[model samples]
Target: MDPLFEFLLRQGDNTLVLGHRISEWCGKAPVLEEDIALANTALDLIGQTQMWLGYAAEVEGAGRTADDLAFLRDAWDFRNLLLLERPNGDFGHTMMRQFLFDAYQIQNLKALEASSDPRIAEIAVKSGKEATYHLDRSRDTVIALGDGTSESNARMQSALDALWPYAGEMFLADEIDQAMAADHIAPLPLEYRAPWEAAVLPALAAAALKVPQDDFAHQGGKTGRRHSEHLGHMLATMQVLQRSYPGATW
Candidate 1:
């Protein structure tokens, strides 16, 4: 696979999988405000996914549209971070996941604002606006919940502990990353580590959330070699409509 295409898939898959997960909370969030907010967040992520995957298709020149790539690909082909695929157990858990991913994304999109590829830079610019809002919203929620009460704080802490290890995957680089970096298309994922930590750690400290002591990073989500069971189940529901009715347009 072309490194650029793989890089695009990683970008799109992260949003697509996580977007579907957030959308699962529609009508199920604790309050009306939260319900609407979750839906809108999902929409933002999905919209970003369209741009990333759309560009990936053009780069491939393989006659696949964004929808085809999104709806037709199997789980093993996905290259999202494993953290996003983890279950959103409670409201606090959801926010922790969002904050972690958004911390990485905020700096990432900012970095991409200087990408050598003009298209990637433009997409990053547009997506960065939404990502800023996402980080702000999610970070506020994390702090509020983590400092709220015994129960809420406990849940937030638990979520942070469980998800922190997965956070390391964002920084571990491979050939695809090297290629992107070498071409000045994008920086190596490793380049974001300091900023991601700078962005994530303080928010977590403010939340009274304890960062997990164990830092065993689960690898292979981006490389698509070791995705968790969660992604397969997600794809089933997300792609079911298109899978069931191939070329069935409304």
Candidate 2:
């Protein structure tokens, strides 16, 4: 496989898996308005995933479609950071997860827009606009939850604690990422983190949310070494139809 193709699949799979997880909140959000908002964001993410994955499939020249790359893949095949697959515990938990991730994604996509690879750059350019909105919406929710009722505040804090470890993986560059950077296919992960943190901290402060004190950041999922427990059930639900009826499609 071409290295760029592998890079594209990694990006697509990350969004697809996370989008699928977030879509679970469509009907279950604590508030009706929030439910709609989350659903819309999930749709945006899935749409972006489809475009990237479709391009990735073409690059691979393997005759696999976007659906094949998404639903047909097993847990081990997914390369999303663990933070995304962490179970959506509560409204606050969901918001916290979204807050951290959306911030990173906005910066990441903006950087990718300038990628030397035209296809990658084009996808990033288009996706960055949607990602900007996602970050803003998620940021507002984080602020609201953090500054809301006592229970909401505590729940948001707990969510941050539980989800923060997984965030370390987002900025840890590996051989694949380095290759992409060297080839001007993507930006260095560290370049995006500072700006992401700058945007996140003020929001956290306004929400009265404290950053997790834990210095130890978890890593290694990119190599498929470790994953969240929720991934199994998620995979079962997502892959059931594909597994049951291989190549079945509408």
lDDT of 1 by residue, 1-250 (tens): 7999999999999999889999999998999998999999999999999999999999999999999999999998999999999988898889899999998998889989899999999999999999988889999999999989999999998888888888999888999999999999889888888888888888888998888888799998999999999888888988898889898888
**TM-scores, in order shown?**
0.98, 0.96
Please give the CA lDDT of all the candidate structures: 0.92, 0.84
lDDT value, residue 55 of candidate 2: 96
The per-candidate count of clashes, in order, stands at 0, 0
> Which parts of model 2 have CA positions greater than 4 angstroms off?
none
Candidate number with greatest TM-score: 1
Which residue pairs in candidate 2 have backbone atoms (N, alpha carbon, C) closer than 3 angstroms, thus clashing? none
TM-score result, candidate 1: 0.98
Give the local distance difference test score of model 1.
Answer: 0.92
Per-residue C-alpha lDDT of model 2 across residues 49-143, encoded as one tens digit per residue: 99999998899898998988888877777777887888888878888888898999888888888889898889998999988888888899889
